[model samples]
Target chain A: MAAAEAAFELPPPTAEEEQWRYGPINDFEIESYEPSVASPGPIQVPTEGPSGAAALEAASAVVTVADGWVVNIEVSADAAALGLTIQAGLNEPRTGFGEDADRFDRLHEAFAPPTLCISMRDGAELETPVVIRSHHTGQGRACFPHAVVETGEDAGLDVVEYQTSTSGKGFAAPVVQLSAGAASRLRYVVVQELGEGIVQLGRILCNVGSQATATAAMAAFGGSYARVRTDTRLVGRGATGNLIAIYYADQNQVHDFRTYQHHDAPDTQSDLMFKGAADDNAGSIYTGLIHIHPDGRGSNAHQTNRNIKLSDAAWAWSVPNLEIENNEVRCSHASTVSPIDLDQQFYLHSRGVPPAVADRLIVSGFFGEVVDRFPGVGIQDEIRRLVAEKLDRRGANQ
Target chain B: MTELVITDLSVSVGGNEILRGVSLTVRSGEVHALMGPNGSGKSTLSHVLLGKPGYEVTGGSVSLDGVDVLTMPTWERAKAGLFLGMQYPTEVPGVSLLDMLGASFAASGIDASGLSDRLSEEAERIGFGQKFLSRPLNVDLSGGEMKRNETLQLGVLKPKIAILDELDSGLDVDALRLVSRRVEAATEEDGLGVLVITHYNRLLTELHPDRVHVLADGRIVAEGGAEMAEKLEETGYAEYASAKPAATAESRFASGGFDA
Candidate 1:
């Protein structure tokens, strides 16, 4: 627990950093946010699994964080039998954990309660996944949480974390870190569906070692102001990383996402794709960067962001940047932000699908591409169901 | 008799006339072949009949079985038993052909939940595979597939009138033969009225038209028996283009002739 306290005292981020740009630092004033001690509050985790939870659970280690404490953590028995360990604190000063680690350090430092540390034993191939649920209840209360996962030599692990709120103006700040060992494979999924009045900040950092593979899936569907930042660093040769993100914002909500792909090793590859849809005065922003160091030879990276604006008032912005100091590198980025195709709508309507139903179908289909990529069927279904519910609620409110 | 009546229709887009003073009658159990050159208003007339947006009826009346259709919306026109096989049908991503056909069948008042199965049977009869049912609606479909899918929709909906626009534009001999067979079946089995707009006489050879009309410069310059189709095909619409003056009114009638 002392190591956890040290993880919180790291230095703060300055405003001039490139990563901190477009972030709402004013809204995250730690001074204004009242700090409350960790409590063993009544845990209300969804037993039946929210539509997509089953699939998510099958792909990763599962943990449930209610209010401000860990309510449930289900490590797969196979993983446990293979010598997986759950540790609370491994407080070490590293480049990503120290002061000025990144913009995500703020969330990590501010929300230090209910922290989790998971370590995979060497050469263990756990087939079943681990799932974690972070839930918030009551009005005006906020929850801060952190989860860290480390895989040893030739180890494989899958982790799923779900963040949800039960009524009231709930808020959450979650930070996730993944460390991959040589020849290790890891898959992670982070899902966010908080209350409308809630605000959320989610951060994910990954370090890929030699011959390691990593994949991350993110779905953000709720919160008034939800921001997510994902950073992946390839530290050794023959490392590969894939990052995918999907979000749906409606009714005056705002969604922001920042992603970084850092290649420091030779023969490394990274791919990123993010898609979003906005409707009814909602807004979305996606900013991503791919950086290749001088020693990162034969590195390849690609990034794409696509957005659909369902209404005239809805808006989306996408910015992709690449900085390559290495000549033997391949990197490309593409983005598109546009309204729904009228011809598509007409074609659907001509077939007797009411305009609204057709719109929903199209939107769902658009998001399905990303959701289906999730490693778990339960998580896919949960995201689908949540999207459907959101669409229904939006329709009713309209 | 069930019929579609077009009375002195003048249709315009952006204040410029495209279908000017055109009148025709298509009765059930008969196939009318409308032959014309490019930009001769055949597609425009079809769009006007279907009540597509952006095409205003400056003057005209269109009726289906004595029910006025000119004032109806596009979907209402479709519900009134009028089907326009678009020249360039739009692609709807992620919407399967079977689902679309089922919805259309239901909207047209057909009672059945297994419409997809029924459609598959019909499609198989036309030499299309059951796998086509799962394909996205017209997305990445070949021209022949698109034409056959249109026929499938018609078979399912069984509308009183169908206006097939350039149905033979991009088809091989086998596809053309299949399409002609489908049209013949619709007219013979259901006593459905059909208006086939084309520039060739090959399709008319397979499915003989009861009547032929030559459209030139936004008006029908000549009308005759099915032989007229062959004549126009041979002459390439040159005779019709030369026979009519460019700016003539063609006819003048208070409410019924080929004049608005």
Candidate 2:
């Protein structure tokens, strides 16, 4: 988008729409926000992968983007030996993933930069993951960046995209398009820790091939009102799609998540688990669905959403829906929104564990089940430390 | 003055009087067996001492050598050397046994440098494998194992006074033998005061308690040596109810006893 193209665009979504319910849809105005003015820097080639603050040591490659512009890309010799390629362009939609579904996609199409593409050869099993960092800077400037990822048959890949804002007031919209080849395995993690004065809107379009596996995990703990929409499709028989997330909203912050799992082939499987905590006067909204078509006979799908309200004024809304056209498919969904358990409190206090410490333990422990199921990308300790800090701050305020 | 004293302790839970004018005391290193039937206020007395929520101490005074237990929070009272071994411990899903014990020690202001070694020694004394400490607290354990775990925590904490609520209910003969040996050693070596609450005479026989009291109608109805426990075992608490009238209302709801 170096040459700004002038064109007609669709209107942004409003809270009155069912798809944007429980979020700050009325506050999103694309017309008022200015474009990013980030200046490009000299690229630095390296023998080793990225290493610094908040950078993973085990990454095979690193890509850095600031204010919607690509700054640098580094790939190690090991990654090069494994036939990995990284490029930049716009990616056409894969099979069964539509492009004209939502207003956010329209916004991404109108303004998002040329997407970065990362691909791996068949049977390549690199142990270290590929790391991507997206940073936002300046006030009143919006950043829109996108990525496209694909893997060959029997290949394996792990990628993590972490988003943070240095010190600014702005809007960020990011999109990720991923497709796993037959019998391939992939895991993707996204973390958001932006500063106070940012509104983030993100989307993911994922597809799993025959006998392949794809897992995506997200952690959100920042921004004034952060919203994410994810869509997963099991397009081939015996394919699996797993979606999980852990998030927190403190003070008056709001976090919204929407997910859709589509089972289009016979004998496919999909599962979703999302957990979060809301503190102070914060709010969280979660709505998900598992859709099984006629050809998805003998498929299995499940979804669960659990939220904890850390304060009396905090609130959460959870709704899980299912649409199945095949009777042979097995599907289930469950959701719960509650305060901390009183029996749990008494049990800890009677053993001389203080109430504040006990709350922190319980909140972290609430996400342990999910963390255990999806192993390998190490962020468990970081999750615990962040949750502890949030609980400590809440306790100090009271 | 050297005793852990409970003077005219009257307590209620959800506005229902559970303990009325209950008074008791035990000197250091003494093993006292408090015998009462189900719902006879034995558990309520334990909960009030440990400051469990919903147990309102309307009129009572619990003190340890002039330190007012009723006025302090639960953790402070624990740091003041009061420990309660619950009958049914709740399951904390992701908090491991090692983490829980470490937090408890930290809260009680105990020296934690040698905790790992002490944990192993305590597990050995209680006949529980040290591997139990790595698992989540009280999750997926046998009934006897849970009981042994509670006794193990009691040994690890090493409080000056311990109140065991039905410690022998779920334990078999072998486990009971192990716990009794640990408790006896605690009382003899550490000058620990023991208050064992149970309805059965088998545990009292094992510990050979120094004093036995029968609680009925929200008050102690009879007190004697170990023979009183055997007699009550044979004839039950009904035989001692007629010896004294129930506690009076004025003493039950007396205001100034709370020391607030």
Candidate 3:
């Protein structure tokens, strides 16, 4: 453990930086939190625990991590026969984060516990998903959960990482690194539904190989001030990367997303879609960039960000940028921030739908398109339920 | 029997009067055709009746079954049995027809015990396949298909009165015939009163009207039996065009209407 003075000595990312412009950085005092210890066993939670969602029953394996430490792991008989190796307490030093790495990244690298690793052999295929439930608890505590998922050549796998926190003034920083081998298919999802008193800064890094397809999906609906930055690199020829995220922020919460889609090789492809809504006095910010390097000939990349504001006090910011150096590549980026459409409300109302119900339907439908594109199954219903719950709370507050 | 009454209705949009002293009534089991040339407040009247915002009811009274309608909200007007078949059905992405039907049913206090089956039956009658019910409401639907969807809603909602504004504008002859026959069926089976707003008489011959009224310069200029539709069709609304208020032309264009 580091000295208390040393923990406060490290600098935090400031609001002036491009990636942290819309973030509430000035209010985050690093001295207010200290590292939390790992539990010896699975932490006992109440019926309304921080992680209320049942372990995806269809999962081939279920793993639980608490306070940045792996607490439990269960592998199904079918998965064990198929030789799916999921082990904890594997320490891998973090490296190669590039120039964008900031103080938070270093802090996470220094403080996070042993990495939980899930590995698959060449040409191996898992029919069901492996779920990881990462929970954060304790007041004024900081926890960093690190995970690394890898698949061999021509292998197929699905992994889900669920992040949650008990209600308290805590800090969480989680990192996940995914490496998809050549000719492999890797699907990964991370859902963040933290408590209202927590502040979370997370990152998802993906590296796609030749002829491989990698998809990353996320649904964020919690946290007082939550921020996630995702970077996907298509480093091999003919590789494909798809990114999708849907976020809803209620109360005074703030949800921030920064995404980068990098096409570094020829014949690569990437498509990204992020849709979010802000209700009550909540706010959302999305900034995305699609970059095609000089050698990325024949590559195609598209980035789109859409947001809806459900109240006069709610706000949203969307910025999409493109950097294309290859003349032969095709790249496009678009962003939009608007309120629920009036014409749609009028249309519903004329059909005997009340105004409140019409707005609810519109908001629900706005996110429905994104929900349909999600690749996972067991968690899709949870996303819908959370969105509806948020809407119900908004109704009650009104 | 239900009755929808309009008394000396005057309305303005952006401080410019679009409807002036209009009076009309349609009782259950009656069909009334409201004929007018372009920019003659036909669409405006329909919008006002369904309580669409942005239109100021300067001096008017609209009541349904002896209850004041103008004082109620748009959904309340719909719940009070007023339906408007829009000329350009708004495209609402991500909202399915089935979802809309469920919400409407609940708002109108109608039982939705078997909404899916009822919707499937009504959709099939109008050639709107069952698959279409799960698709976004009116998104990418053909013009004829949108009209059919509207007609399907008319059949399902069974409102006491319906104001169909240019229901045949984007329809082909066969689609017009199909939609008209469906409307006639609703009128016959449920005593559904209708105020058909149109620029042409093509729809009149399909569902013959009990009374035909001509609107010129926001006022009802002529009212007669069904033969009046035939006479107006031959004359082509030329006299009515000549009588349009000169001062209203500029305001109409500013309000998004084509030049008369």
Candidate 4:
């Protein structure tokens, strides 16, 4: 009970905070929501291969969130061999919970019966990526998931998170924090494909230590209203970060994204590129900022956002901001929003390329810039196939 | 016989008349020269024949072997063996010249296999290098290169009727000779009907058209055999321009007769 009381204390939000400036806290109109009881459900662990159910068996940890509750938890022997610990349900069983439990804490207290926590020992490297899957299946319910990843000095880790749904009208609020120790490297990727009636708010925070590097790739394809926020802070000199995102929206859906690149120490570098395409009355909004502190000298940052509007009614808004307070810094940002050229269309059409086929080719070429930047050739091929499938579906529907 | 017959054609832009009662005929296996001063509606007539937007065909008919050409869409006209070698072709960035030619052939119902070989052979006939095949269509190309590129399209497309709009505008002597040779080859090999629109007799000297018509004040002021071109070269267009008043006459001097 004392532990629950200690962890449930709410922190006041400051008006001067930049992150909460446009937040919709007043819409919720709640001082706090009481934490619900944590009820564990049936755990279904598939024994198939990674291509099927068997791949989950090789994951360092697997956590499932169903019907606004964490129903299953699995940690593989490989993770145990690395001396990792799993933490979940930090507050209490029931009575000790209070109204001060915020949305994330409420989810942590109510639904998260077991939270998958992974830590790497010094000089240890995990060969397989840790998989965390959150499945929502309920009407008018919301789920909150929190993940904390930490790596010891000189350790390496890879994590892949998948957020999806079986069927339902619900919201998923997922928060992730990654801390990389000195000389450690981490590669993280998140794939979000929720239902059309679902609203998702995903936030990821990363802290990089000296000589460490981090790479994060995000792919968003489904949701009624989806917003992904990534905040990366380079806390040590000579640390590097790379962030890449690609999104496709169709129908009456809307996708919003906010990214921040913070350089807190000298000799830090970051590069970010986001590409998006909207069709069939869909819209997208992207806002990115690169911040360099006064003492953060010798920093390099570049950010680019490119969008394509397939239909006349579809629209996209991009805003890139750069705040540099130190000398010897290199920073640049560029954005473009325009319709496809009619001359290009006519040229392609003149060659007997049908209108739809021409449009698909142009869209594919439009998003190819980001896809080509992917590190692995296999990943690039897979992304290309996924993009082609989405384009085919959109073309067929039209 | 494949022929393009333009009779008493009048076209207007922004409600202002540019071509008034112009008449001419281009027969198969023969070349006809349309010589006129600047702003005399030579290029305007070509554009109107291609059915470009905003150019109103207020009067007259343009027909290809008895089919109405002005009523058809631009691409349909192009597919129906009517080609316009634009004086100033619009540059389309990111589109390769080879690809555009291949697509044009496919759109015109021509098979696409061996298309690159065909384009290359035609390009070689005109002394164009193979490196030119990879460049974007008309983007960053010189005026002479643009003309040759258009002629290359002419060779590959092999249109029955080609309207060469001022093909000799900015070419040097070497380029002019090259273009004239290609036109001569097209006429003999394909039995193609050609309408070479120009302002000078230099291109006509090498082209040697079957008939020459002097266009002035939006109408044909005089028509004669190839010697009419020589007369214009010797006398310039001063006499022809002065003799025409404000009269809107659609006159045709057939063989050796003049009604007026």
Instruction: Give the per-residue lDDT of model 4 (tens digit) for A1-398.
Output: 55445444544433244543333323332223333234436544222221124435456777665544566667777777885555564432232223643444444444443444556777788776666666665355666566667788888887766666645667666667777888888777776667786777677778888888887888777887777778888999988888888888888777778898999999998999999988888988888899998878999999999888888898888889999999889999999877875655644543334566656666766676687665444445546666777798888998
Candidate 2 C-alpha RMSD relative to the actual structure: 4.0
Clashing pairs in 4: A48-A53, A48-A54, A49-A54, A49-A55, A50-A55, A351-B103
Give model 2's DockQ, 2 decimals. Answer: 0.58
Question: Each model: TM-score of chain B?
Answer: 0.92, 0.91, 0.91, 0.92
Q: Flag the better candidate by DockQ, 1 or 3.
A: 3
The alpha-carbon lDDT assigned to residue A243 of candidate 1 equals 94
**Runs in model 4 lying further than 4 Å from the true structure:** A1-141, A147-163, A178-191, A208-213, A393-398, B1-260
**Per-candidate TM vs. native?**
0.88, 0.91, 0.94, 0.67
lDDT of 2 by residue, B1-260 (tens): 25789988888888878787788888789999999777778998988888887888878798988788998878777767788888888788788767777888887677778888888889998889878877787888877788888888888787889999998988999889999889989898888899999989999878879998888757776778999889888898776554452344555444332211
Residues A352-392 of candidate 1: C-alpha lDDT, one tens digit per residue:
55556667767776776677788767677778887888789
TM-score leaderboard ranking: 3, 2, 1, 4
DockQ metric, candidate 4 = 0.17
Better of 2 and 3 by DockQ: 3
Query: Which residue pairs does candidate 3 place in steric collision?
Result: none
TM-score of 2: 0.91
How well does chain A score by TM in each candidate? 0.88, 0.92, 0.95, 0.81
Write out the backbone clash pairs for model 2.
none
What digit string (tens of lDDT, one per residue) describes model 3 on residues B1-260?
A: 99998877889999988787777889998899999888889999999998888999988688999999999989889988999999999998889887887999987678888888888888877666677777798998888888888988888888999999889988898878878988988899999999999878899999779998888767676788999999998997877654533223332333322234
